[model samples]
Target: MDRVDRIRERKREHLELALTEASQSRRASGWDDVALVPSALPERSLGDIDLSAELVGHRLRAPLLIVGMTGGHPDARMINKVLGAVAEAHGIAVGVGSQRAALEVPELAPTFASVRDHARTVPVLANIGALQLIAQGERPALGAEKVARLVDMVRADAIAVHLNVVQELLQPEGDRVTGPLLPALAALVRVAPVPVIVKETGAGIDRESARRLVDAGAAALDVGGVGGTSFARIETERAGVGEGPFADWGIPAAASVLECRGLGVPVIATGGIADGATAAKPLALGASLVGIGRAALLAANDGVEAAILTVGRLIDELRTAVLLSGGARPSDLMARPPVLTGATEAWARQRGLLA
Candidate 1:
């Protein structure tokens, strides 16, 4: 098969493998390690608790983002449509998978565009790989012009430049050399119409890198840390190989949120965020938003109604969590500290993040 065909095949494989149990990280995502201190006497009712949140100037009915999952294939079109419809109905943010495939093959553009086509009212995030921003061997760098086209293609409210270094390395036909990524990213930030959000695919970003990205004009950060979908594992599975040593590699989601927060940019805590309670943990740890991946994908697979049902459950649970923790809104969790233990606490202590 040619490069385009290979990409299409890989996209299909990713959708399939990600749903399997083996593709999930065996290691904890640190949500389990962080506990919210319950309010024995709650002052507010559940209806009074607000889940609405704002990120990069976009107001969301819930502090939840349906993290970018798929696109670039015929099958993905329906998936994006379903996810977009769900996000539209809820007034939340939604993202599309990397637009590289659609960029290379214009015929596939509608696949990713489906998100914006359906979710007209909410924020839509356009995606591109971190490595694509710079020259990689024979391939030319996707400079400002093409990058701007990505935003236009989806009418994206913001652009998400995904950092997937490990996923690239694990894939059979991956780009190896990531040349001077920071400067190229800074250049993109200069010309891009909307806010630039530097996101991780699965591996999390460290404090140093997070600070640098923020300095480079990143409007936000999606700490797509380990513990959710292990793209490394998914690639390995696609390669028909065993679960390698790097299967559970990278910082946990909870730790990554702590690392990225307070850097003067909003952090979207992703990875291993399965439920509203799990989603609440990151917010209490200072994350401005929580991203749901695998769980959303599973629900979308069942159809739009099923996905809406899942989202409703999550929103309800999130409201309950905020109320039980003595909060009236999602942002309130940020001030109402959570008790950190296990590796999450150790990570905070060692990183000097714990006060």
Candidate 2:
């Protein structure tokens, strides 16, 4: 098979392996012991709790959006359709994976087009790997704008410029990602003609990087932090690349949020977030929204209703946690302090971020 065929095959394998083996041991994204303390006799009304939130120029019924995964392939459209339908129904946002394949074959538009048509009336986000901003030269630059405009094409709300060097290094036919990424990113933000969000796949973002992205004109930051999908681990196993004794890699979700605190850009916490408390921790530590992927994928495989049912359950858990923390709404969680400890603390201290 050629490079293009290999990418498509890898997507299939990723779904199967991620669904099965990725669940083997609950790889700790280092949430072993950090938590937000519950408020005792707090002056807050749970009855008045609000789940409504706004981000990336769109309003959401909930604060979560299933982050980008795969969409340039035929196999992925069905999944996107199911995910999109549920996202719309629930009033959350949906982000399609890299659209490079569709760029390769305009015939593939239907695959991603299904996302806009299938979901409930919710915000959808177009996704493209950041490297694409320059790889295909002027066409890609123009394509980026066309992609940004595709929100209208698919009725999307925004777009995510995803950075995934780790995944590329591991993929068999991944392109040679070169050049200074920030300038290209800044240019995209300046001219994309849509709200652009800069996101990391799973490695986490520090305060400095967050600040830089904000300066680069990112509307928000989705710190798809470590402790969730270890793309390094995933790719190493799949494409058989990257050999550096990664007994482990990635900064945990907790540390990522802490480092990004007060950076102006809202941090979307993802990576190993599983439960109500885990969801609450990042918001408490300074994340704008919490992203759940693999867990959602597992739930989604059962069908759209099953998927939304699972997502609803998670939302309920997050709401309950928010209320008990004395937070009147999702935004209030951002004010409560999270007590970071253990490895996550060490990470904060190393960066002089722990306070």
Candidate 3:
């Protein structure tokens, strides 16, 4: 098969693999180790609690985001439509999966563009792989122009450049070069029309990497840490290999959130955020927003209503978490301290991220 066919097949494989039990992480996201202090008397009404959040200059009704998942295939069109509609209905942000396939084969553009068509109001983000940009050769300026076209294709309010070295290493046809990344990312950030969000794909960014990306001009960070969908496990299954040590690799989502603290740019905590209570922990840990990935995918698979209800329930749970923690708004939840324990505490101390 040609590269276009290979891309399409990979998209299908990704969706199918994501649905399997093997793709999920066996460990905790470390949210269990973080506890929010409860209020004796919250003083604020439950109805008064606001979940509004600002991302890349767009105001969302809630601090929740539906992270990128699938595209580059015909089936993905419907999936994006459902996710985008759900996000639009809830006044939240939505990101489409990588547009490389669509870029390579213009016919697939509608698969990603359907997101913008359905979700016209809320912030819709365009996505591209870091390696894909690198593969475009030495001209960083040329890559920037292509990325700008992707933004226009989806009318994206922001663009997410995903770094997935682990996934690439595991994939049979993955790109292996690690050099020339920072400079290329810097060039893209400088020329891209919209705010650029540097993101990870299941292998969380450490403090040093986060600092470098920020320095490279990333406007935001999406810490796609561990304790969630294990891309390693998915790739292993795809390769017909049983579980391996790599399945549980990468920095835990909670630890990654701490690593990104004080970086100035807003952070979107993702990976293994199963429920609303767990989702609230990251906000307190300094993340401006939280991303629900596998959960959203599973819900979308069940049906559009199922997806909407899933998101709605999480939003309700987040609001309840805020009220119980004595906060009147989702943003205020960040001020309320969390008692860190277990491996998360050890990680914070080891990384010097703890106060």
Candidate 4:
């Protein structure tokens, strides 16, 4: 393999290992502070709860979304294939890992493309890094003319512009990050033909920034919040490195969803979402959908069927949550009365949002 490909594989391995071990760590989303109060009165049946959700004009069969995991490397292709097959089986949306590798290495395109190949029914979003595109320099100034071409290559339903500064700063072989990022995003949103989604890798986007992103034409937002897969911590374990107390540095998935609500853009909750209850929390916090990454990877390792089954269980839980709350659909879960106390409550109240 070439030097870049080899380096990519190494990083992928590190991410896989770190995520597998994350649950054992002290880090938690502090969800203990937010409780979804149980209903005592008459309620609907779980089987009737509609998991359908609308995102970027497409309707997803389930409220659970498969967050972007590995790609670009050879091993990642197989994983993506497994993930895509399952996503299609369940009729849920999926996101491909950072497509920077495809933009660089031509041979890598098919692996990422396998998503559309395997999952024709679900929406497949292509992912790219803001920093990487910016490093391309004159590309955006030229109207990102080639950007749509790249997205089309994989039949991406939408394009995810992921903000991964923490991961970048963590890796020794990482790229540079300069500030004043809004203009470039605005350009991508205007230039790219498909809908543009602004996403965080782990650190969630806050209210003020979400408002600006919406103004700049972000069709949707993925709050890849903290409490799951601390990319900073992942890098630290990989290189025995630290970004000086930046390990737990991000907004939890629950809080980020609440913080960025009503920005004129659809919001997705990500990070620290492993099971059905965790996945449902984001929906309760006003997220259009909930995303799970690390859990899928862990499930994939056991085999594709197992991975899909794991996701299916989470979906079942989401439906149950909606029914128990006397709601008929996944969106209704967002409006349920969830009692909040402690840190999660404080996080919500700090932003003047506790619903």
lDDT, each prediction: 0.90, 0.74, 0.88, 0.76
Query: Over the full model, what C-alpha lDDT does candidate 3 score relative to the true structure?
Result: 0.88
Candidate 3 residue pairs that clash: none
Residue-wise C-alpha lDDT for candidate 1, range 1-355, written one tens digit per residue: 9877887888898998888898899888889899998889889998898888997798999998999888988889999999999999898999999999988888889999999889998999999998998888888888778988899999999999999988899988888986688998999999899999999988899999999999899999999998989999998888888888998889998899989999999999999887888889989988889998898899899999988888989989999999999889987887778999999999999999985
Q: After superposition, how far is residue 133 of candidate 4 from its true place, in Å?
A: 3.1
Q: What does candidate 4 score on TM?
A: 0.92
* Candidate that scores best on lDDT: 1
Give the CA lDDT, 0 to 100, for residue 201 in model 2.
82
What's the lDDT for residue 259 in model 4? 82
For each candidate in turn, give its C-alpha RMSD to the true structure in angstroms.
1.0, 2.6, 1.7, 2.3
Among these predictions, the greatest TM-score belongs to 1
Measure candidate 4: CA RMSD.
2.3
User: TM-score, each model?
Assistant: 0.98, 0.90, 0.96, 0.92
RMSD of 1: 1.0
Regions of candidate 3 where Cα sits further than 4 Å from its true position: 136-142
Q: TM-score-based ranking, best first?
A: 1, 3, 4, 2
